[model samples]
Target chain A: MRTAVKKQYKVAVLAGDGIGPEVMAEAEKVLQVVADKFQFGLTLTPALVGGAAIDASGEPLPAATLALCQQSDAILFGSVGGPKWTGLAPDKQPERGSLLPLRKTFDLFCNLRPGQIYPAFAELSPLHPRVSSQGMDVLCVRELTGGIYFGEKGRTDTDAFDTQRYSVAEIERIARVAFDAASKRSNKVTSIDKANVLQTSILWRETVERVAKDYPGVTLEHMYIDNAAMQLIRSPQQFDVLLCDNLFGDILSDEIAAIAGSLGLLPSASLNGNGFGLYEPAGGSAPDIAGKGIANPIAQILSAALMLRYSFGEEDAARAIEQAVQQCLAQHIVTRDINPNSTYGTAAVGAAIVATLRQENR
Target chain B: MRTAVKKQYKVAVLAGDGIGPEVMAEAEKVLQVVADKFQFGLTLTPALVGGAAIDASGEPLPAATLALCQQSDAILFGSVGGPKWTGLAPDKQPERGSLLPLRKTFDLFCNLRPGQIYPAFAELSPLHPRVSSQGMDVLCVRELTGGIYFGEKGRTDTDAFDTQRYSVAEIERIARVAFDAASKRSNKVTSIDKANVLQTSILWRETVERVAKDYPGVTLEHMYIDNAAMQLIRSPQQFDVLLCDNLFGDILSDEIAAIAGSLGLLPSASLNGNGFGLYEPAGGSAPDIAGKGIANPIAQILSAALMLRYSFGEEDAARAIEQAVQQCLAQHIVTRDINPNSTYGTAAVGAAIVATLRQENR
Candidate 1:
């Protein structure tokens, strides 16, 4: 029997703007620890995005960056968009230039946002003790590249318009992603929309129903967006996997992340059928906190863990990183975002997680 | 001096399907008491709706019912739609007939939903003790009539489309309603939308900003719907009034209601510029527990209070009814929904509230 050579996974890292560089540095540190512990052959390639790229070469996402992303096994993105580059026109906007291009280029159809409450930092949650005790953990599987967000728009003399469009093929493909995700978790997927009011939502529901037959093992439920919003607040734990269109997904996912306590700590991954995935923190670039040495790094570190599991097929590496994060929390080692009294900077928090990983490995 | 004659408000009562009848009856009882106490005249006109109407009159909302709603001073609508009526065509659906028509007919531009955690029923909430401590109370001022829900829709052979259209006028009018509402509350309004992604949302933000200048005393903040959703779950009390477009309003109002713990105790009022308003329970008709006589009547009773305040301008009566509700909860006179072991039926809950009001008056 011939021994096969294991391939080295390549990651394209886009440290966009503001705290993006700081957080991305922490993620890289965590990734290094994971690679060393798991003995996985990995190569990290850094690329420019957002205002950084705009400053360097008058383009937010240069051709070279795109080429690197295409060739990489996975992409780890830091936060994008800030007031500094917002004055630019629609096409020149850093967010559109970088994030949208990646989404469109990779055809990243499914965006996975897992809102999990870390037990140690549960005190930081603003929810009433009774509400938070129920364990607020939700996985929102948003249709990334379709629906109203990508629709055409125009403005007239007296009226303005934006198309809210969807196709059966689009809905079916996203529904399949949701069903697959539901199978891995609690096996329940709540498909949310405004089916009662919108034609697109009706089509969405119809397509979901049709596609649901293929995933007989997963339980499916339909809820209007309004009711879904209320249920999210009332009993978040009742939901396992939430499947929704692009616009509603954007709103609901953010809301779920907010409820979990800190936006600074939530990471997300957008993936496609080709195994090409883009992992990033759910938060945006806080320009005010830029270079302040106080921005949270946990979200980026967690994104690296997601990158390992999703792109590199290193489940053990992912688990090890996650366990190290939990241990850090258990030891009350956190950043200023969750605990202001403690004077830990971004690098300190990243160092803590890395130390925890090393200790656990030993 | 000429004595001003008190206006006799005409209220169209649509007691449709399941526990709808039970809750409607209780609301009617409370409203009658309010009329007597306030020395105002209220004529309750009954109308047919839902499956019951479809069965007996062959129409969910007959033309006569629409005419009655239009003629009435206000509408006190009970819940509609049930599994038994699911077979009906989309147009003939009970919810479409009763709910949508009522909204369209009146052009109810403003939806007012107040979510307050009852201190007496704090134990009933699933939230942990710390999360519910400060008490969650929010007034959701939702644009009821426009945005994506009411936009144009059609389907082609290859795709389906809906218009997510808004004009400056539409956004401005709704923004004014929110500002006016905030003036009466905690002087803060959070306008929610996806401004980063949608053109309609950007217009909505601009309109809200313009409207804010007119109400200099009221504090205004802009939040993306996603973040708003999270904030509602984490720190609901921090929000005083939430103003958003129709679609977002529908979702956020429901979410806010959920955080308050009991949908069975929430009520909403839809209003237009003409001073004509429609009051209804936020909770849907529970067909499953319909005839069991175990349905919670507090929400219905609260709807009656809203009817008194918004329709009849009997603010004192509204306050009395609200006080009575608080007294009922404080005295542990809740229905089975909040207190499962309690033997109180719909009638008993209504009677307790009425009795509390009478005692308070004495």
Candidate 2:
């Protein structure tokens, strides 16, 4: 750690609830292995969140945890909520109480939900064999902080209303986020909206078009949300980066996850105006499998890879982790979630990935 | 000259534009055959609408077309619009000027978009053979007259906003429509909304819960819109009826169609509180194949079947028409759209369907 060649980074690891802690532990093991191999020093601070935080401190996102996260270079978030948190008020739920609040506090504006089916598991797809053979990698770059989710809502005597509002400045920033993402990947972005019907969508399309002039390296296309919904299944491989508002993003992101068939293989990143982010697996805590040690940990380990690339600018370390995951998947050293009869435990899969990294170094 | 025991019904036919006239002709031929076989008298009235109306009377939905529809028992509508009417202002477009006005005039509050994969052509599905072989038949009963589509929307200096409001009464009626449809099918209804996020959706869920008590014979379940989106592909056969708001319907209905592969096999109906309705094919006018006599007439013919069942109370007649269309598909008597290498034209397909009816009668 004292060597001039070594770089040090702090990560706030909030293992929220249920299977979250188990998955987080395995992810940390991978992070440690990569840190040693890449000559990087990692200092991880464990924090309680969601139901765990509620049990210990009577708050979902405790002040201590938030304080720790504010000082950290990155966040490695595990899934939150379980049957134990079911009786809480809607706002007090793990999602509304901790996740949304964390994103809001950090001013996270862009949510990247990337769904890619690893070639070894293409047969697991719900789509036709011929369709799955084409392969699919769609990154839904969603504007998280604005649009209807943050708009004003109210009730009247006979009616209840929620407003869907968007501003030019808000739209421009999200558009730039999407274009930059496209440049790094497929160099294509499909901007989704209901422009033919809604005024917000019309403005969204217009604003995205104006912002496209800055990114001459990326190609731009427009699709109605309705058609985009159908095209996701009809030809999911045709998509690259699907830029959407909060509501559409929530729906389409989940749709893409189901299309991939292997939910455990997916990871997500929420980025602020700067490149800093909270990286997490795009799945929920499995209360049913909690403490059983059989829950899938690959998504969690992949989230750590995303944190390296996006937060620490450790691209080499990120690729090493990602390639190790592909190696484990190819060898079928996965947890029961990916294969019903899989004998590997959460720890075993994690150890396999780290061993792969060591083997590659040899 | 008239048989006193025979019943008669007036049908106003609007063969709108492009492939509309060709498909409408085949549908009428089937109607003529069914009327003769069922001992029912038929009176068909032709009216101009869409681009054809625009060319004839300088309006998309002319007074003459409106007058004809008002006097008819049921309206059999074909596809509409083409390149010829592309220069008009937004409001004067064929869809906004004609179809919307007709729906508004008729007080059509409920839209039924039923998607069923033709049994013989299940291989055409984009879903995995294992997934599609489950045989999906989901009916999306949508509230057409209310919700955000009809709510107040405006733009200000810094923002553009749309209001999504729902009254209890509006939710109850649409819920009832879904439950009734479910009762006739698999006896299950999945009400979809973003209740946790939108206040309108909260009220919607509450109102639907209140209405479910009246439908004692039907099973009711609630799902957030995002989960429902994933479930549609993850396990499509699980759904019986999907009751949604206008915007959700606009997205999910199209999604269900894509699941089934060919849009030509679907038909839709828009009805007011009463049973009177306007029936139409689910696909759009194919200007590319227009006047080539090769457009698929099955959807247009099925629209007539929907008219018989929903509007005229001719259930047996409707089933006969439906079965006949199925036979046509089974026998490979389909248009080029359904089977590109086929020699079957618009007229040949119609004649083939009529021959099946005659054979079934024999």
Candidate 3:
């Protein structure tokens, strides 16, 4: 009899600084549980980044680490930058030195942030129960590399200017990501822009509308940026996927995160055209809580879930991990961030999630 | 003893269309009560505008109406536009033809929208009790004629662009409005911009900081626009005055209004350099409820109060009107939009507020 091998994925893991290594350990453990249950091969290569890399090699991102990332299928990033690296030149700081370079080098043009107010924890939301009770699951798909953020900017003695520019191809790709994500969820998308005022928005609207034809199953809706900001707070449950340009996305994503309540539970992904991605928690590395075994691991574990869903195409495994996290949260087996009354530590919460996933597999 | 002439204000009242006339009538009634209590001479001139002007003279903004507004100290505007004017061309539409022309003609570069969630009606807020119970009072001071909205824009076959340009003069004028408003309220102003990446934002921040020197009593804080959006939802009460360029203001003002709950209770002001202004409700002409007596008149009443405060510099009169409205809301003497169970109509609500004002004076 011939020996059979399970399919494998190599992910470069950058456990950057502070509580990163600790939370990442929990996410890795959860990934191991899912990989075993789903019968898939998983190889996670750990590499130094941020303050850790700086301490070891006098740089935030080591050449060896970048080479390793280049060889991997995807990057699993923990949070970066802490007070320890704040003494360095602004550009030499961990976040600026490491993450910016990685994103630029990889040409990561799309950013997807998943913001959700779990019904079990709806009380955490800033919105009233009438609105929060329905819960909100909005994925903000933002075009990262284009728009005013990366456009031509100049200043004179008397005035200053920043250009918001978008190409048809740029809008189309981000729209596809939104439609794809929407198709997997509620099959609806709300494309936000100021079409009545800006020429870029007019082009964005036209391109997004054209992209809708390709995804026949997914419905598309257009909303002005101002109205979208209001609607997100007034009725967040009405939105499934929100597509935005760089500047608008930067605003709305933070707004969504605010309404979602706990930053510890949000995960983000940045990707390129080739489907290669870097996944991480939207929350920062809490230097204050580092080495205390009390940091929330849900964001990291969810980032791993996103990695499985987007990078590896392991939908079943991804959902299983998501359900496990939800179950753990619903059961009140969460870290202090989610519930101050809960005495659970990072390892305990991770174990509870793993146990839930294993129980579901059986 | 010689008879003294009271300080008089010339106001052009443009009750445009639909419920505009009815709401304007109630607002005028409230204004009359305040004028009598405060002992100020008030000269009110009636003028045609919007659909009413179009019906009378085949133009949304009649030349006679413009001349009347120019001659007055301020314009007391009722809501404009209705389904009746939908057949007109986009440029000839009631809203575009009237308000845009008026704003442009007067060089109304500053827009002040006051969004507040009264403590009595906290339940109407989209925010949780923990957030809304404290009540929110944020004045959004926006640069009306600068930034991306009025910037150069164009489209090509492959791409499109919008230039967000800001001059020192533009930023200074808007910042003055914010600082002056803050000096009247909490003496704190949060300037919103994207200074990290955009050159225009850098100029905006620099200009605002320079302007702050003139108002040493007022404290100044700078926040990135994205963080401002998040902060607005997270802790709206922490804000007193929010200063923004055109685009940021457009988005934040709507968000503020949404969180404030009842749009029928909000008021707005657009002013030029000379203290001349156009005061209006931050809502529409509700054609469906035009002839019905059920239309809420608080917004229009509040607009009159803003006119007294900004245009005529009658701060005491303004505060009196505001207090009367608040008393009516606290007593549940409101229209259907605010309280469905309340039986008060437009005229009745106006009468109740006037009664409250008269009672206070007695």
Measured by lDDT, the strongest candidate is 3
| Residue A190 lDDT, candidate 3, scale 0-100 | 96
- Candidates 1 and 2 compared: the better one by TM-score is 2
**Interface RMSD, Å, model 1:** 2.3
lDDT per residue as tens, model 3, B141-243: 9999988988899999889999999999889999999999999899999999999999999999999999999999999999999999999898999999999
Give the CAPRI rating of model 2: high
DockQ of each: 0.57, 0.81, 0.94
Candidate 3 on A99-160: residue-level lDDT in tens? 89999999999999999999899999999999999889999999999999888989998899
Using DockQ as the measure, which candidate wins? Answer: 3
Task: List the candidate numbers ranked by lDDT, top first.
Answer: 3, 2, 1
Query: Could you tell me how far off, in angstroms, the CA of residue B326 lies in candidate 2 after the best superposition?
Result: 2.2
Ranking by DockQ: 3, 2, 1
lDDT of each model, Cα atoms only? Answer: 0.84, 0.88, 0.93
Model 1: per-residue Cα lDDT over B1-362, one tens digit each: 98768768899998888898998998898888888877788899999988888988889889888899889999888898889889888879898877777777788888999988777776655455565666777888888777777788987645788997888887787788788778766799899988777888887787788899999999999998877877776666688889988788888877777677788999999988777888889888899999888899889889988878776677889989999999989988888788888999888888998888777766
Which pairs of residues clash in candidate 3, taking residues 3 or more apart in a chain or in different chains? Answer: none
